[model samples]
Target: MRRHKEHSRRLPAGPRQTGPRALSGRLPGAVAVVAAAALALAGCSGSSSSSSSASATGSPQASGSPQVSGSPQASPTPGQQNGGTQLQDAYQTVIANVLPSVVQITTGESLGSGIVYDDKGDIVTNAHVVGTATTFTVTLANSTTALDATLVGSYPDSDLAVIKLSSPPSGLKPASFGDSSKVQLGQITLAMGSPLGLTSSVTQGIVSAVGRTVTEPQGPGSPGATIGNMVQTSAAINPGNSGGALTNLDSQVIGINTLAATEPQTNGAAAPGIGFAIPASTITNIANQLIKQGKVTNSGRAALGVTARTSFNQQFQPAGAVIVSVTPGGAAASAGLQAGDVITKIDDTQVDSLNALTTALASLTPGRNVTVTYTRGGTTKTVDVSLGELGTP
Candidate 1:
C-alpha cells in the first residue's frame, strides 16, 4: 500500500507525517512534523515567509490572480451575451462583497491571509499563520496601509486563531458567515487570500466534498492534530493563503482555507487543485470561543495523555509510538503505560505509526476503557485503560 503523507499548510519546518495506513497509504514521519507543531504550540518565534506590499490595489488584475475557471473563455456571441453578462455580473458582485473582508496578515517576517471577523476589528486566521507572534501588521483589501493587530486568542487544536486590530480603520466591513450545514458538493466557491504573499488574490472552484477527515499538526494531545468534518474544494490554496476565506457565490464565508494535498511520490508535489478548508461551523464555533474566553473550554474531542513519536523495532521497519513522555497520572500512566514501552495497538486497530495511534485514540471517548496492546522487553502485553477528557495543558 502507498503511504499517506499529511502536511500542515506551511510551517517553514517542512511537511511531516508518513503512515502505512494513512489515506490507505504510508505517511511522512511524525518525529519531524510533531516538533514543528510543538514549537507552534509553544508560540516559539518563526521566520516569516515572503512579505508583500501592495503594488496596485483597486482590484486584482485579471492576468495575475486566480479565478473561477482556468480556461480562456470564448467571446460571447450576441445570442449568448445575456447569460454571460449575468454570470460576469454575479462574479463581480461577490468579489466586491468579499474583498473588503479578506486581508493580508504579517507576523514578524511571515505573511498569511485573514478575514475581518466582526465590527470590533477582530480578524480570524490559521493559528500557524500567527505562529508565536501576538502582534501583527494587517493590510486591508484594496488598501496598502498596514495596521497594528494583537492576538485575541488561539486554538491550535483546530488550527484557528483570532486577532484584533489595535484600532479599527474607518470603513471596516465584517464578513457575513454562512451556515456550513448548507454547503453542498458542486457549489461554487472563491478562495480569497494572499497566496504566495500576493495580497487580495482569489481562486475559484466548486466544493469537491464536505465532511472530509484530515489530521494535520495541532490538538490537545501532544504532537497530534486532527480536524474532521472539513470542506474539500478544488480551489488553489497555496502558501500565504492560510487563514483566508472560502466564500460561496452569495458572498457568504463558508470555510477557512487551510491545507492543500501534498503527494509524496512525486517528490512532495502538491496535488493540483486539491485543497482543504476548516468548515465554517468549526471556525465559527472555535473562533467565537477564542475571542470571548481567550481559550477553549469544551473542545468536545478525545485524547490520550501521552506524547509519542514513531519508533522502530529490531526489524528496523515501522513499529509504533515509543512513549517519549507520558503525562503522569494521565490515561496511559493510569493504565500502567510507561516510557520505552512500544504501543502496538489500541482496541482492534493495529498501530503502525504515531499517526495511526493518534487516529485510533481520537476515535475513542476519553472515559471509555479500551484494550491497549504494547511491547516491553520484546514481550507483548495488554492492559485496559480508562481514557480521560482531552483538556488544555
Candidate 2:
C-alpha cells in the first residue's frame, strides 16, 4: 500500500488542476499574462479588377464621401454617463464597509487571509492558511497593529479553520455572510486578500459559474481536499488569496477564496480568471462547529467507510484502490465489502486509486444508493452500497 500519488490524468479540454498552492513559502506573485507572440493581420489587398472598377466609377466620389461606418457619437445621456460612476461608487462603498473585516494572517513562513467572524475575536479562514502553526500574527485591514491569535480548530477536509485573537480588539467589524444558496451566476464578486503579501488588495470579477467540484493537489501543509458546490469566479485568485473573502455587490461575504486552476502546459502556472471558493454556508457551518466544539463532529460529505490505499499490479503500474480495512456497520461493511477487495469503479466513474475514490465520493452525498464495482479474490463483483456521512478527521 504505497502513498497515493497524483497521477496526471488527461483533463477534458480546458484548465486541468485546481490545486491551491501553499502560500507559506515562495509563491507566485500574480497571474502572468501570456500575450500572443504575433498578430498576423492578413489584409486583402485591392485586386486589379476591383481597382479598375473603382477607377471607372470616378476615384474622388466613388465611395460617396467614403460612407464613414463607425462615426463617434455625441455625449452619453445623464443616466448612461452616471452608470459607470455609480458602479464605481458601489465598489468603493463595499470595500470601505467590508475591508476592515478582512485580516492578514501571517505564520512563521506563510501568509494568507481571514474574515473576522465575530466580536468574540473568532476569525474564519482556510485550514491550509493555518497549516501546522497554532499561533499566528494577524493584522487588521488598514491597521498597523499586529495582534496575536491562536487557532480554535481546523477542519482540513473542508479547508476551513477558526482562530481567536488573544486580546479582543474594539471596533472589530464582522463581515456579513450571504446565503450561498442564493448566490447566482453572473453576479459581480470582489475578492479581498493579501495576494503576494500586498495587504488590502482587491480583485473584481463575475461569478463565472456555480456548484463546481474542485480538488486541490496534495502538498505539504495542504490535504488536497476535494471540495464540492464551490462558487466559480473569474476573479484573479493569486497566492495569499486563500481563505480570504469573496464578496457580492451587497457587501456580503458569499464565499472563501480557495483554489485556483493552474495551466498544466506551463508547468502549473496560475490560470487567471478562474478560481473556486468555499461557499458561505459551508464556512458558517464548519466555523460554528469549530468555534463551539473545537472540532467538526459531523461532516456532510459522503464516505465509503473504508481504509484503503492505492494498489498496483505485478507490473508495478497503477491499478485500483485496495481496501485494507472496513469500519464495522459502515457503508462498505454493510455492503459486504471486506478487506482485500480492490475497488475499480464507483457508479460510472473509474476508481484507479484511493485519491480517485475520495474524489468520487466528494461529489456524492450521504444516504444515496450507488453501485460499487470491485474485485474480490479472483472474481469481479458489484454491490449496491449506501453511502455514509463522512466523519471528521
Candidate 3:
C-alpha cells in the first residue's frame, strides 16, 4: 500500500467531528460569514414601532395562516423566507433530485458510494472502492432494497471502476458532469458521500489546489504509482468517500473525492484541511471505457524493472521506483539497460522523480516503443525500448 507522509497543520475542524454531516441547505462556512456581516447591517435598522404593534395585535393569528392579505413579507432570517421552513424546502429539493441516483457500493470488504453515470444503470466509483470485489451490492439512497450489481470493468492504475446493476431502482436522476479543467482555485465545492458509513453526508469547501499527483497504495504485481492531474480541495473526505462526487455550487460534479492528507505531525498529532479528488475529465474517459470494454486497452510499451531514487546525490530517498533488477528478455534488458541504471526520463518527458515516471507510464499503453533515457556511470544515455504488458512478470 502507498504510505503517504502526513504533514501536520492545525485548521478548524468540521462541525461535529464524528465525520461530515448531512447538509441542512444553509450557506457554507465561507458564505455564512459574508451573510452574517450583511445581516449585521440590516439589524441596525431595528423593528419599526408600527411593525412591532402589528406583530403584537391580530397579526399573531394571521402569521400562522397560509394565506396572507397583504404582500407576502420578506423573511427576517437570512436564509429563511416567510418562515423557517424554506431551508428545509431547499434541502428536500436537493435530496429529492440527487439522492435516487446515488448508490452505496460494496465490493470485496470495502464499501463506498457511487453515482449513476447513465440510464443504463451503470455506476461509476473509485477503483479502490471496488478493488478485487468478486460480488457487488448496490443500495439506493432513498430505499433499503439492495440490488445486485455486476463488475463491468476496472482500471486500478487510474483508480476507476464501473458496475452495472441487473435491476436498478426507478426514478434514477443521473448527476450532471461539470468541466474540471475550468474549475478555479478558491471556488466553493461540495462533497456528498457516506463517510464512516453515515449516508448522505455533505461537506463544503473551496478548491485548495490542482494538478496534484498522489501515489497509489502499493499492491501486488505493481509498485506504488502516481495518480496525476488531481483536483485538491478543502472538502472533508473520509474512507467511505473514495468514490463520491465533488460538485460545484450548481450541483454539477467536477471531481471525484478520493484522497485526503492525514499526516501525523512530529509532535504526534493529526492535521486537518487536506483532501484530494480525481478530476471529472479523467473520470469520464475511464468510466466510458469501462462501460464499453471490460478492461482498459493499453498501447503496449516496454517494461524496465527498475525503481528510482528521488535524488542522485542522496543515497537514500525512497521516492521513485529504483531499478533493483531487470527482467531477463524484457525490453529494458534488450536495450542494454543494466541493474545499476537510474531512469531520468521517458521519451522527451523529464522523470527526475519516480512519481513523475509513474504518472508518465500510466498515460501510455503497452507495446508502444518509447525512448528510455537514464543515467549510468555518471553518463546519460537514451535507449529505444518496446513496451510490455504489466503483470507479465
Candidate 1 has its poorest 10 consecutive residues by lDDT at: 47-56
Top-TM-score structure, candidate number? 2
For residues 243-307, what per-residue lDDT tens digits would candidate 1 score against the true structure? 89999999999999988877665566777778889888778878888888888766655666888
Residue-wise C-alpha lDDT for candidate 2, range 304-345, written one tens digit per residue: 999999999899977899999999989999999999999999
> What shift in Å separates residue 213 of candidate 1 from its native position after superposition?
3.6
| Model 3 regions more than 4 Å off | 1-96, 219-223, 266-270, 298-340, 345-353, 359-373, 382-393
Ranking by lDDT, best first?
A: 2, 1, 3
Q: Model 3 scores what on Cα lDDT?
A: 0.68
Q: Give lDDT: candidate 1, residue 125.
A: 89
TM-score of 2: 0.81
For candidate 3, what is the TM-score? 0.64
Each model's TM-score, in the order given?
Answer: 0.71, 0.81, 0.64
Measured on C-alpha atoms, candidate 1 has an lDDT of 0.80
In model 1, where do residues sit more than 4 Å from their true spots? 1-86, 215-224, 265-269, 324-341, 361-372, 375-389
